[model samples]
Target: LQKACQSQENNRAGLGADKKEWIRTEDILERLEKVSDDRIYRVKDALRLGVPVNSVKKLTNIDPWYLMQIKELVKLENELMKFNIPEDIPEDFFRTLKVHGYSDAQIAWLMRVEEKDVTRQRKKLDIRRTYKMVDTCAAEFEAKTPYFYSTFDTENESIPSDRKKIVVLGSGPNRIGQGIEFDYCCVHGVKAAKEAGYEAIMINCNPETVSTDFDIADKLYFEPIYWEHIEEILELEKPEGVIVQLGGQTALKLAEKIVNAGYNIIGSSFDAMDLAEDRGRFSDLLKNENIPYPRYGVAEDVDEALRIANEVSYPVLVRPSYVLGGQRMRIVINDEELERHVLSIFKHMPDNRVLIDQFLERAKEAEVDAIFDGEELLIMGIMEHIEPAGIHSGDSSAVLPTYSLSEQAIETMKKYTAQLAKALNIKGLINIQFAIKDDHVYVIEANPRASRTTPFIAKAYQVPFLNIATHVMLGSKKIKDFEFEKKLEGYAIKVPVFSFNKFPNVDKQLGPEMKSTGEAIRFIDDLNDPFFRKLDSERSMYLSR
Candidate 1:
């Protein structure tokens, strides 16, 4: 019996070891073709484990040249890891790493130091990046397009004009939470900046966006929205200010880094963004302002999560902090579900924490997109979601000129939004979500940057809200300076468009996480028009499919 038990234990241990080996092999192969959150680390791990390039190529089916390039990078990283930070580092070593596309964040991790230390060292060494122009004709003609790229070279092609310039950092990529809506805002922001007599410069890496179009701005930087890349551009162009609000959370996340490096952020301050995104700070702000919010608790472990779940009374809306598109957000109704979900999340994201809020069942959700300059507030339009509060606003069908909200409720929402904006000192655009439960309004979430509904609100009201918000950010116009049509002649319905047919394996259920890839808009003069309403519904369904 003892021998039998030992055999079983050995088999289990072998199975566990085999699974880990398979995962390591799979992860190394995955890093070759597509980028993962920890692709670099995985590559480094495979190299350290002495995985052969031929083996990686066979598994990943990637080209040998690319594999060799990655191997070289891994070698460099290994060599750099041996050096003591301030003592043994070479003078040109950092520049060499930067030339090979190594980000400061990665170097900081290797050196066991803060990213700010790397930035400070690079600045102290005067190892600056040069900007090269992306003339549309490839230098064949005097091209009017002012696109630029960065490199470690001697001469820079970018020529600063006499006109004041404002750099617009674009939303990096079209992901679930942030899609083309932000790109639309960036494009319009460039136009508005140009119209306001400032040279508009765009910085983005997404080729799929209109903001990357060569003609959209006076100068376009086809580069990643990394702190290192942005710092180079700021040094070269010396723009009057940088606008971070129009680009979604991608740009907003860099506000503090940019500001700490002594770059001027034109619109909403970094403190305002922190206040809105940080759960504890935001909770305190709401408490001080006497604003109503759902009961909530923050947890970093399963015990804390369970405690919070029990305190919040069973049904709780739980999500991780500092995530976009409500990633990994779930509705937990029992301790079992909470434990399972929390364990799964911790397994995947060990460093991240969770927030649990009392779920407001069957509440009506409304979104307000408003522009706020320091002194004045312009409520663009109130949108009422067709679905309940649990569904993400991006995935829900929303109607502008709110179909169900009462005048009193709308006024209350506006008042709350204005108060929050004022308290945050927001200068450009702000989107706030409110839940109406038991005839009381509760603030759900607030995004100080441009929301996904900016374009929808602009089309519904026939006002250039994006452009107006840009001007507001540039301090060229106040909210009251521009006139917006108070009442819409027709109601606009913004329906989410899904690509379920393209990805048959994905579940087709609406939840807090945004799943829709795009959206379609429809207009109706009257909601009571049955024939038109039916046609509109059919069109919306067809488009969504």
Candidate 2:
């Protein structure tokens, strides 16, 4: 059983608490070659319940050292539970907890208080973290690489430079909705920062992305996206400003907190981001601009959602506010489905409000990537989705230089795009999605930051959109100062790639929620290609394997 659990741990397969009994009874140790997170939690629980460390080690075949560490963690939790208020928290106590990898949220759970309270207490204690260099050459030679990490220990390795610097927070991880596209933007932003004679600093945790590469920027900090982690880096770097627009929802979500802490935001203001994300605020803006949008309502409860559904009529689209890649978004056709969906959403995200919009069936969906430099707005490229509305834009295939929309409609979209950008006072990249039904265009969504389509649009137009946006954000250039290629002679189709074959048990159906893992772009000189005929002929040959 121990060998089986070890194997499972190696495979990264999680086992449940129910597997404990099976481990005791079944000799199917060969079948149980992995351990799960729940199994480790069970061990912790057993240790907390006064089970001897040696006994746990005997049963699970885990190292005695690991068991002792778990025992210490449990003891710490028990000690933390004894504290009643902020006054009871000793100065060194919080520092010790942080050194043990106790996050503010975890400490909050133990202390029965809000996470913000923990943050406040930590700040009161003045327990700041120090930054350390990665030291790729073992400190043998002075390295120019900016790779760094944070630690509670004393010695600081991040020496402040004399050059003006712009800190770029990278998207923490490569999850769906926030992936390589944002990294692409970050890389370009770093390059632009260097070209503009400012030291570029990148902070991110994901090792899978180019943004985290040691040499990508002047300084790189591999750190979590938590408030405390960012605060520490900011204290050390003391940058001219931080750029949040290129980091996707991860960095965008931090704008409010960072701004509230009085840090300078270089690109779009937090108010602009809030206006774009908050459904109520965005709806008001659209109304003021006379921009058409689907009838929608925001609800904090199931009753409110149901009422909104009735007002919007059946088949309403629902999503949580401030989410990317259409996470947990769904379309419901009836009251029963709506209620069930709302309940499920609230189960995981109780604080989030539901946004209900009248589903526009058979609408032609389109996307526009534009750059706004406070005064002037430049539309980079307009992409029309091949699949009709309802499919998530990230998962839908799109064609550049829209093949479907009329010239007049395209012009109207550009006008609306500029109007929205100016109204928001945007200073960098902004992406907007629209739906056209019955010859009327309705705004579906607007992101006041770089969208996944920025890279694709940039490649299509043969212009570095992110680089230009970065310079614009830094007050180096305006929209009209640079010559841009607005039109391309050929068509480019963005085809989404899926990882469904790797997860056979998961459903392959695509809908409002994004499901594609990656995307590929294919450019053809002519509308009709013999290459497509060859692809059709070879489809069966590829599928058989």
Instruction: Assess each prediction's global lDDT (C-alpha) against the native.
Output: 0.79, 0.80
Worst 10 residues of 2 by lDDT: 9-18
Off by over 4 Å in 1: 1-48, 142-144, 347-351, 528-545
Task: Name the runs in model 2 displaced over 4 angstroms.
Answer: 1-68, 114-117, 138-144, 530-545
How do the residues 1-545 of candidate 2 rate in per-residue lDDT, one tens digit apiece? 22123222121111212112233323333222346434675676666666788877777788999889878877877888789875588878878877776666567666667778887788788766777778788879987667887777767778888889899988776767778989999999999999999999998877889988898898898887656678778877788999999988888988998898788999888999999999999999999999999999999999999999999997899998888888999989999999999998887677789999999987889999999998888788899887778888988778887876888779889989999999988999899999988778999999999999999888877898899999999997777778766556788878778888977875666688988888888887864666444533432231100
Displacement of residue 161 (Cα, Å) in model 2 is: 2.5
Point to the candidate with the largest lDDT.
2
